[model samples]
Target chain A: MSARATTRPGGRSARVQQSVHQAVRDLEAEVGRDALTVPLIAARAGVTPSTVYRRWGDLRELLSDVAVERLRPDTAPADHGGLRADLEAWAAQFAEEMSSTAGRTYIRDALLGDPGQGNAVRCSDYAVEQLKAIGVRAAGRGEAVPDVETLLDVLVAPLMYRILFRPSDLSTVYTDHLVAAALGRGPATPQTKS
Target chain B: MSARATTRPGGRSARVQQSVHQAVRDLEAEVGRDALTVPLIAARAGVTPSTVYRRWGDLRELLSDVAVERLRPDTAPADHGGLRADLEAWAAQFAEEMSSTAGRTYIRDALLGDPGQGNAVRCSDYAVEQLKAIGVRAAGRGEAVPDVETLLDVLVAPLMYRILFRPSDLSTVYTDHLVAAALGRGPATPQTKS
Candidate 1:
């Protein structure tokens, strides 16, 4: 990827980046992701194709950048007075967002052409930070909170696996079971296999 | 995707498939996946490019097919006298294989350009079949067996998630915890988060 002009203070470079990104989003929604091309995005952004290429390196990298931005949580995870409630709410919401068609596309785009795995790592870091916030909240309330990795293994992994593969049965029930398992409660009724 | 010419009995078509698949494997190892093209694969397989294109639709489809075949387990899940032991052994082995660089590449190939999700579903079916075999063996020995979906969500999901995203901690200990969780054992000492 090209050296991103990300750290520059507000100026023409940042404006151009914003316009190009907005163009990608607008074109993506209108024409869909599969049909997207650099020239079209540049044309819509009112920039030359060379400008887009020099900044983002390729379409995949540009898409990955957009996906990371989209995946960033808009707010802190809600606290529900207890770790179990907190986790159930968070897991359900996370699964619902990620299982959507657009969400899935962003995830695939984030992982694609990620030669250094930086995009994937950044996405994972977002999840880790959210989980840490929940953990801190639970610890403050004196509830015995499972660690973040434990939550990741028991809760997030199953949600993602189902979303990306067997997506037919992603529901509140499944997230509830994962929360229960992570809390050391026994397998609270295994999801019925189809 | 093109309508596959997969239904005819073993004949010229089967030979063509075998040769093409072998050519893909050989060329992927030699020239690397990114360097490959239909023309290169066709030339190596002693068939015309149109033959490959007609049968497989495109390079991504052909790669997906090869990945699914590579992912299929060659033998039954080994019986280890008890469900926990059985799952631990199988999970560890599965994690090891899927965490390898080659295995990760195959998985990515399997999922990419999978419009109907047939390739992804076939890979999931392989895991399901293996888990079912383990469950049946455990039940035959009077050991309580977790259902296939439970095994899938708890055991296979974490392994895959870790493999694809957070791969540094994929080890026997991680697989052991997943198996124990599926067996209703409490999270076996949460993996040391990196």
Candidate 2:
């Protein structure tokens, strides 16, 4: 049996995990990542220092968990009957999440900190999984699915770049263009809808 | 006349400016941005700390100048006979520069350090100018130049995203695809070249 299986579902252990994770995000938003400490996180979480230390070994480990949790999409990409609609929905959702306060903090830490860290790798993998689902759906319809890397380059990466370097509202118009480009349908039309 | 016009071309002042800029890049490569300091940079450049202070006034100013110089493409996107070739060449050069040690360091500092700073703004403007040149060239060729913002979203932003988040060799095939997508030509073929 797995270690996770030992814990009862929605029990005190789960409550504590949820609280601690929330505390980490709250503290990070308040103080920024550079000034955050284990003791600070413990105090904020209403947990003991020993508990924080034993559970997470170091600040990096704890941050990685918190970051990945916040960075992951709130819901999986929906199958919207066609590849274009599915991709547009996914892109729009991804863009919205990344523009949130928690998302921005997580991304900044992931990029500026060690690139080979668990958090960075986890985030990349998470994005790939989402893209893979879209590609699979596209293939099911017999539409030519763009390679995962190209999909990332044309659609996801640009939105992410804007999130970091250029702060702007992630519009439907922009996401549609990205989707169209990825699908090899050329630039999106003005009337393209999600 | 501007303050810049007062300095004789290729004189001692120019020599000092060049040496100091080179020193900043070399120091950043050796110790990374977080560890860098004015005294150390001045020493490396063989200029007195007072001289460094008197001219640039601070580390951020000095770093900004160095970064803008390195980040700016050595030459504007050449005509290359067609819009696709010109864009491919521009993207390739941009990707190569951002992959270099100095380019990586500059970008890290720009993103992590105060996002509202002059350095980040200057770099963004530099990129816009290069994109504008390509658009103007396309217009000259009687082709539809994608809107400047779309050009950035499709062509430039993805490459910047890759340079930071994913440290792979920036492929020519990838850049050509970006250009094709920007021009509304569709996904690039395997044989796509500059």
- The candidate that achieves the highest lDDT relative to the unseen native structure: 1
Model 1: what TM-score for its first chain?
0.88
What would the per-residue lDDT of candidate 2 be over residues A1-194, giving only the tens digit for each residue? 00011123787667667767777767766987678898888888789888877876777667766666667655567989888899998888888777776667677656655545456656777788988988888898898787777777778787887777665557887788778777776564343221
Q: Quote the lDDT for B141 in model 2.
A: 83
Highest-DockQ candidate: 1
Q: State the lDDT of candidate 1 residue by residue for A1-194, as single tens digits.
A: 11122344688888888788788888988998889999999999999999999998999899888887778787799988888888889988898888887788877777775756788778778788999999999999998888777777788888777776675566777778778888887574465534
When summed lDDT is taken over every stretch of 10 residues in candidate 2 chain B, the lowest stretch is: B1-10
Model 2 ranges off by over 4 Å: A1-23, A29-35, A42-65, A141-144, A186-194, B1-35, B38-69, B141-143, B186-194
At residue B92, what lDDT does model 1 achieve?
83
Q: Top model by TM-score, which number?
A: 1
Model 2 Cα lDDT, one tens digit per residue, B1-194: 00011123687788889878778777877997678899998899899999988988788667756655665555567778777788888888787777676577667656555445456656666788888898888899897767777777777787786676665556887777778777776565343221
In angstroms, the error of model 2 at A102 is: 2.6
